[model samples]
Target chain A: MSMERAIGFVVGIVAAAVLALIARKIVARRGGATGEYDERQQVVRGRAFTLAYAVIMVYLAVWMVLRNVELPFFNHPSSVLVGILLSVTVFVGYSVFNDAYFRTSDRPGTYIALIGAVGLLNLILGIRHWVRETTLEGRLLDNANLMVAAMMIAVMACVVIKLALDRRSEAN
Target chain B: MKNLKLKSARAGRDMSQQQLADAVGVSRQTINAIEKGDYNPTIRLCLAICKALGKTLDELFWPEEP
Candidate 1:
């Protein structure tokens, strides 16, 4: 297909992979031998996820309806990608909102902000793609790919550094 | 947010979040949140915190002195 769409697909895949790694770590940490996630945390997470799922489904329905309508600036793939990004973002938002409200925790806000930033970045990328009908091999898509890759690497690096520091302190 | 004298005392004793959580039978995240003033401990948890830090309730959670 178009270069922009191809770039979006690649970015989406990379984002999915990064999110998977983060989720795996969260699950492992939560299920570790020592002081794992309590029943209350699980209950809160379950409720939040349920609400997220509902919001995602509703977003999908709305997206489908909007796709049929002739929108001037919005196209098929961009709209679809935006819908998917927003769906996942809604989940992240739900998690942070629930954590802040019910658990009185502030840590989840960081995760929420990160997700929101990524969503906004993707939305910008989508709009840029629509304007510059470039091929995946073109400069625009290549730059976008590089930017996303850099962000993923940065996130992974930060996590690794934090874990290393934690371990080092524990040993001392 | 109220100051966490218990956490401050525990830290003064060179105890980590995990150590304090273990002593109080709670998660490390809970200890971290409490120390950061992002959580309000229950009465039972407050007692546990006081016990862990080797302090009385009044010392750890004093009223606003006039």
Candidate 2:
């Protein structure tokens, strides 16, 4: 509720939105005459998503349990960011695992894995206050870890399900 | 677990992944993925591959069930 925390949250949201918009534009540009998410890609993505969703559901259960237990540890803004980064890393990790198991050769799996790992490490440092938590006027930063986790889950689920459905329809 | 038909047909035709992809109007990466059995091609793309290699769907696909 403090000025600094509000600024940080706002900045995070803005950064996420900007990245999403840029990614959408890139996919759009690649479509040429036909739309991107072609039939094959959709199928591959769907399979990957199903696996990612299953893994995330498991992780979410664990997160909820941990939250309930409340480790007597301080809740920091950095923790929320770490949660977000971990969510991404786990998703991509599962995606790559799915690709390798299914014998899908798309290198996007590798790229996502690498990016997720780096983001995860950064997130951990940020969340632990190792990177320093913002404090101004004695007001605490809103470490919306649950909210961040939910956002990441929603974004990933939407992407995977949409592509899967698209592929199914195209196949039919 | 190998898709021997697809692999042999691709080889018999003297076409590499890049060559097959160029003929089929897809990326070489796509072809590589397909050959590795890491991906299944769409119907349209499967048809394209079939046509390019002078084979039918039954000939290229439809292996014994595992």
Give the winner by DockQ. Answer: 2
**TM-score of each model, in listed order:** 0.42, 0.55
DockQ for each of the predicted structures, in order?
Answer: 0.09, 0.16
> Per-residue lDDT for B1-66 in model 1, tens only?
646676678878799877887777766656766677766667888898888888888987675567
- Tell me the spans in candidate 2 whose CA falls farther than 4 Å from its real position: A19-40, A73-83, A97-172, B25-40, B62-66
TM-score of chain A of each: 0.44, 0.43
Clashing pairs in 1: A3-A135, A3-A136
Which interface RMSD does candidate 2 score?
6.2
- What is candidate 1's lDDT per residue for A1-172, written digit by digit as tens? 9999899879978998998687546534544322345333555467767776777688778766765785532334444444454554455444433332223222333443454456466557755754676665343333443344334344434444554665686799
Q: Let me know the TM-score candidate 2 reaches against the reference structure.
A: 0.55
Clash tally, candidates in order: 2, 4
Candidate 1 wrongly placed segments (more than 4 Å): A1-35, A38-65, A68-172
